[model samples]
Target: MKIIRKSDPVNLRRTVDQGTVEQRKIVQSIIQDVKENGDQAVLSYTERFDGVKLVDYKVTSEEFEEAYDSLDGEYVQILKEAADNIRAFHEKQSTKSWFDTQSNGTILGQKITPIDAAGVYVPGGTAAYPSSVFMNIIPAQVAGVERIVMVTPPGKDGKVPAGVLLSAHILGVEDVYKVGGAQAVAALAYGTESIQAVDKITGPGNVFVALAKREVFGDVDIDMIAGPSEIAVLADDTAEAAEVAGDLLSQAEHDARSSSVLVTTSSSLAEQVQSEVEKQLADLPREEIARKSVEDYGMIILCETWDEAVDTINEIAPEHLEIITEDPFQELGKIKHAGAIFLGPYSSEPVGDYFAGPNHVLPTNGTARFSSPLNVDDFVKKSSVISYSAQAMKENADKIARFARLEGLEAHARAVEIRKERWKS
Candidate 1:
């Protein structure tokens, strides 16, 4: 990792919006093919990209049963426990339809309605993430979404991983499809003969999947265009250098472009953390990926003071922020932008990633500055409720007409004028 002093200017915005023009073009072509050709395009792309040919794309009940049987008793039990934890946490975020009545016979409020159906894309290439299934599905369930579909690339044998299938089965999600990459995204956005279209799409995927989501955003609602995972640790002299290093590597191993940063007031602590990162990277299984990530995007930044460190963290707006100072809560009040905050050494980032109740799907690549973490709200739609009695319309119609006329919308003004004339009698 590189050591950067506070004097150097950090351009985090530029680093976050790193997408190739060629990638966008390719993703656009795939989306168009899916929109035009439907299931055939999905099948062809699945074969070409995933190196697998499938007779049927949907996972049958027998497949689910087989997957459940394949897994050990202990792992299945753990998944159930994790699902309960996720459901309980998201249930707190669930909202209800509320209304307010006024003395003048006006009723206004927000009506909360869950999207009819939602699709989640889980990557099946290098790793299998059963945890993602729990995180994505539980929130939608809590929001009262009736139909939840999942899409993932199948292996060369044309079979989804047993763990992935088992996770879906545990959640009672039957519509698991054996398609992935940009094609799966297209299928979710534009309905295929086999896989029905969904109102919204969510989950993490590769660059192709991310670009596909960006392309299909308007056709269907998406969570966010997530980038590479990142973590920033703000430490002081009291922090353990080894623990800080471990937390940085936790995100670094996610991808070659993942950013891991450490901003500290103590120069000695900064040096110690940097050394600890190097020492730990040698033993990691994903050493090559983590090493490249650390060498390129990782940094040990030396700040002159605690305030400077906090300012730098806000500018970065990292996906995950860990404060390992003597008084971590004191520093927490100063943090304004971060997807998830981990306080103290004991509160590691992984706890939120898997077992903890908070949704692991977080905004990445400086997006936390404006967006938010995935929660029950992401699965639901809100409609503004507005009702006015005859007297209330008569009282406010002239003002509404005047406001509409200011915008040169004559028809809008006339509509209000007509209602006002009717109520005046």
Candidate 2:
């Protein structure tokens, strides 16, 4: 890891991917094919991209039973507890329709309505993450969505991971399909014969999936175009070098492009943590991947003061920020950006990523400056309720008409005037 002062002119931003020309053309073609041919195109792409052939794409009750039987009883109970935690957290975020009547007889309010259906894509080509199933599906359920479907690429043996299926089973979701990549995204956006289209799509995938989400955004909503995972730690001398290094590598092991940064006031602490990261990297299971990440995107900054460290963190606007100062709670007010904030040394990033109730799907590539983590609000929409009464309209008609005419909207002005005329008659 390279250590530098905060004054160094190093660029802290990672370039977000927009897909190559060939990639974009391919994604467009896949979406068009899925839209036209439906299930046949889906099956064809599943065979081509996922390297598997399926007679029928949907998961059956027999498959669900197999998944349940395959997983250990202890692991299944743990998933149940995690699902409950996720459900509890998202339930608190649920919104309800509200209305208020005005003294002048005008009724105004907001209606909160969950979308009809949601499709969650679980990344499953290499590794299986039951945690993602919890993070993505629980929020939609809390928002009261009627139908939820899961889509993932099957293994070479033509089976979705037992853990992924078990997570769905625990959540009471039975609709799943053995599909992935751009084709899976296309099917969710535009209905396939077997898989119905959804109002929104959530979860992460490879480059093709990201590009497909971008292409189908207008037709269907997406959570965000996620980049590689990132974490920024702001700490002082009081934080342990080994523990800090462990936390940094936790995110680094995620991908080669994943960024792990350490911002500290003490130069000595910076040097210690830097050495500790190198020492710890030798033993990680994903050592090669994490080493590339640490060598490429990893950074250590020596800040002159606490204020400077906090400012540098805000500038990075990382997907995950860990505050390990002497008093993390006191320092929190200074933080303005970060998709999720972990405080104190014990609150490691994985706690939020797995067992913790908070959604792990967060904004990446400095997007925390304006965006937010996945939550219940992403699954539901709000509609304005305006019940303008005759009393309120009569009192404001002339002003409304004049304002509309000022914008040269004669028809808009005349519409309100016509209503008044009818009332007078």
The prediction achieving the highest TM-score against the true structure is 2
Q: How well is each residue in 1-425 modelled by candidate 1, as lDDT tens digits?
A: 88888888867542444359998899999999999999999999988999988778999999998898898999999888888888889999888999999999999999999999999998888778899899999999999999999999999988999988998998999899999999999999999999889999999999999989988998899999888889999999999888999999999998898999999888888888889999999899999999999998999999888889999999899999999988999988899999999998899999888887898899888888899999999999999999888778878888999999999999999998876556546
TM-scores for every candidate against the unseen true structure:
0.96, 0.98
Error of 1 at 417 (Å): 2.5
The lDDT for every candidate, in the order shown, is 0.90, 0.93
- Across residues 285-336, which tens digit of lDDT does each residue of candidate 2 receive? 9999999999999999998878899999999999999999889999889899
Cα lDDT over the full model 2? 0.93
RMSD to true structure for each model, in Å: 1.5, 1.1
TM-score of 2: 0.98
Q: What's model 1's lDDT at 401?
A: 90
TM-score of candidate 1 versus the correct structure, residues matched by position: 0.96
Candidate 1 runs further than 4 Å off: 14-18, 423-425
Q: Looking at model 1, report the run of 10 residues with the lowest lDDT sum.
A: 10-19
